[model samples]
Target chain A: MRLRLTPRDTSFFDLLADSASHLVVGANLLSELLGADRAGRKAIAKKLADVEHAADEATHSIMRRLNSTFVTPFDRDDISGLASALDDCMDFMEEAGDLIVLYKLDELPARVSDQIQVLQRCAELTADAMPHLRSMGDLTDYWVEVNSLENQADKIHRKLLAQMFDEIADPIQLMKLKEVVETLELAADAFETVANMVETIALKES
Target chain B: MRLRLTPRDTSFFDLLADSASHLVVGANLLSELLGADRAGRKAIAKKLADVEHAADEATHSIMRRLNSTFVTPFDRDDISGLASALDDCMDFMEEAGDLIVLYKLDELPARVSDQIQVLQRCAELTADAMPHLRSMGDLTDYWVEVNSLENQADKIHRKLLAQMFDEIADPIQLMKLKEVVETLELAADAFETVANMVETIALKES
Candidate 1:
């Protein structure tokens, strides 16, 4: 682990991490809805909203932690970045849910499914990376891998955009798809941010 | 007065701040070219190009500082947000340069000028706000003032958007105007992000 804090410092990372996973949970629900029947879609959408709302509360908790605690487990900057990055991941998930509702996407998008898989993978990486921050010999490998996932997200994002523009001749559809793809990529970017902060922390710990 | 850093911290804050103000200089120069005479307009456009280039350099420098530094004068997240916000402001100025070049808008736009003025004011406030972040006693007043500036920027953004939609008759023209105005407003939102980060830091510092 890169960071070697006593158990007291672990809670902050744990809470931040729980929030990060919750965002992934929200994304999972959203992805499931994409594949579900109409009734199931509606139900899953509602569930996704609930998850997103909970994620908001989680963000508040982290923010409160950020304010009250002075001797943070790690660098104060890393804590702030981690918290904001987690919140941003959730924000993107919520945006994806709302966008699904707004666009009334009748079926799951293949690209969206692909993107969600990437999001989930990164979430797992984030969860895994936290513990290693405590005194890991080297996390550059994890950092690099996480960056790769972000790039994969970017790949799908660009492909989806191109598909949207190429396959859908409608300007309005193009715009809508552009916004959706952008939001998805943004979610991945948040993960990349977490990765970047993690790398910084790793450097310090090393 | 609100921020409470040692004198050493102030020097770094000053550097980050100088980067921000330098972009405003670009904006101010760009504003002048808006209503310039034929040769004067061309001269100002070139000058705007130089300012835009300088902003790019500033952004690079800020990010480099982020990469190398361990103990920041301010919170890491605040630095990140401020760096982005500062770049965003410069981006707004760059877009103005693009608009000037694209539209052949020789005369300074009242609306554009208004937006630029607001932006300069916002940048100045942001510069002022950072110094206050380490001190908490006067934090409330500064935050209120920053919020007020943000509000003013929002109002202006709305009015500019309304003007774009209503007065611009041609579709192509509308597209150009909309992009410019929206970019400017987005820049304002970026500044607001900085303010919000500052408030968060203040809450922690206090």
Candidate 2:
């Protein structure tokens, strides 16, 4: 047990967790969008957009708290960085969903589903890990796992790129699919960034 | 004149300037590549890669100095953030150049040059602004100009996208050209990020 003279504001943990929880919902919505027809995807995408807006509000709350608070649980920039990175996870997922509807892409490469699964797992792990910032314990596994998941996501992305160029005959279709795939890859990278920030915080605290 | 008890390490300014100078070389190389023949484009891209590699080393030096030195000129994360952002600008420029070569894109849309021109200006402005960081003086113009330039780049990017999709009939050609254009747009965004970081630092220091 540890003791402190000044009580640190701990609500950042809840805000961060709240922000990450959106990623899980966003990723699952993306997965659902993949299975739905055009009309269904449009509906699912709208829901995803609403969730993204909510996530943005959550991130703003974290930022407002960070600016007003004098004694932070961790470094100020790290708190902001963590919040922004979490927001990015939601943004990219939301973008991927939107592009699918905007481009009216009827078919996506099969591996795109693999990409979403990785994001879902990352979101779950990140949401689970935010509370641990208080203890700074049992975090090594979370970061390590997210790092490995990102690597897997990278492999899938490259392979999907190769597969798309090799098989997709219509150039316009190829363009739309490529953009959507790349956006999903960006989402995976964002999750990795969040995990790395958590690793930095945990290491500093340890 | 500002008086301080501890003398801050001033070399970070020079190191950052050195990193940013590579962007000037890189954006020039990219511009030159756009005008070159296929073989010439390949050679110019190789040169740009070397410049990018050198820029990477410059960024690493900043990171190493930041880690070993106790006192930085600004917030430690801000320093790292600026360094990473500068590196990203170079990376995106290099990728745009490389894709031009790899895809063998013979005739890019005319607006593509406008995108590179924006980058060239941004790079020059960024290299110029890094030294001002030491003084934290005369920086408002730098960020303001870069932000405006980014807005210009965004408009150019959207026009280029519409122009390409409208005029280019072959989907494959459009894919190659679009990737190059998007990468340049990203480079411009990265420069804006560096400018934003500078703005944050100057405000904090003030």
Candidate 3:
């Protein structure tokens, strides 16, 4: 079950999706640095920073749209919650990247990239849910998928952290690994928040 | 320029501070283990767990009080936020203790114990601020002292974290040290959140 909305709702929802998309790219770019050169890692981190900055701008626009428009998609708090949740995800991702750079981590493990991919897909799936949000419809599938991706990210995160302590020998590297992995997991948590909020809003609309 | 309230508001405020006071004692007990016996540490951790459980119950009562009792000592949200924030501080403190046991961390740094003292003082200062929350009517002294204590805790948090990095030899220990210190900082951050909330309430009341 869901509620129906006009084109204006569609536009705002689309922009929100776009904002999430940019943030997802930023999060993935952070992981994309795993098998990269010192220069490559540095470059990717910068790209992440760039996208992160763009995501901030997108969030501001979303807020503006939220304040001005009257007839909207879903509840106002839901819209605002979605924006803040996406922003939090990006914030955690960017912080993970910054930690990697700050701690001078040379090579990232394979699992970090896997989590990043999951994060990217979650953002994409969440975007897909937005159009559905415009019309009162079955959002169970969307919410479930978003949550599934986040759970996958969670698995990847736990494995990475355990490996950091169990397998990694370099103490400095372990320190860096622990922080980055925790930060990555926080991003997943942020995505989960978004999914949960969406499910609640969808239920309300229905 | 603060809103004046009756003594009844002050007592309602005391319940929140009293919960935090219990947490302060738990924190002191947790930190005392750095110099105590093995059995003592375990006992203290258990005691802290008990305090944490009680704090949650107190928080729930405060929330119920807010909802059912229309005329709160202060604004409903202000009381609500203070109660919740105190709970968060206790949660982090309890979690940090849980990690210590889970990780089997043998000895805590002296600096951490020092931070506990700072945190306890912050809690005390926080408790003192509630009576002054409604207005500065001869209460500027307490308000100013609360802000000063919060600033002091912030500095201690930063310095203690830096000292931790300089002292730990093992990389794994370094990782754990960083996590513990960050949590401690977060504990202090919780106090700061309360102080900021109190300050805002004071300003509005004034």
Q: Candidate 3, which segments miss by more than 4 Å at Cα?
A: A1-58, A66-82, A94-167, A188-206, B1-15, B18-22, B38-43, B53-77, B131-139, B154-168
Best by DockQ: 2
- lDDT of each prediction vs. the true structure? 0.70, 0.89, 0.72
Residues A1-206 of candidate 1: C-alpha lDDT, one tens digit per residue: 58845344556767776777786677778678778767677788788878877876776677667667756777665676677777778767666766665555565458988988888888777777766666654568778988999999999988887777778865544544565678789989988988898887777866
lDDT of 2 at B94: 89
Per-residue lDDT over A1-206 for candidate 3, one digit per residue giving the tens place of the 0 to 100 score: 67655445568768877877776577568657766767788888888888888988888898898889887766777788788888898888888888888778777787878877777777677666766766757677876787678757755765666566677787767767777887888888788777766765654554
Q: Which lDDT tens digits does candidate 1 get at residues B1-206?
A: 58845333344565676676676677577667665776787778787778777767876777777777767766776676667777776777677666666776443336767776776776677766655654545655555676677667766765665455445555555556656666766666666666666667676666
Q: What DockQ do the predictions score, one after another?
A: 0.12, 0.16, 0.13
Error of 3 at B35 (Å): 3.6
Fnat, model by model in order, equals: 0.08, 0.17, 0.25
Candidate with best lDDT:
2
Give TM-scores for every candidate, taking all chains together and pairing residue i with residue i. Answer: 0.63, 0.71, 0.62
Better of 1 and 2 by DockQ: 2
Q: For model 2, what is the error of residue A8's alpha carbon versus the real structure, in angstroms, after optimal superposition?
A: 2.2
Model 1 residue runs over 4 Å out of place are: A1-8, A36-57, A103-109, A131-145, B1-84, B90-134, B140-178, B196-206
Model 3's TM-score against the true structure? 0.62
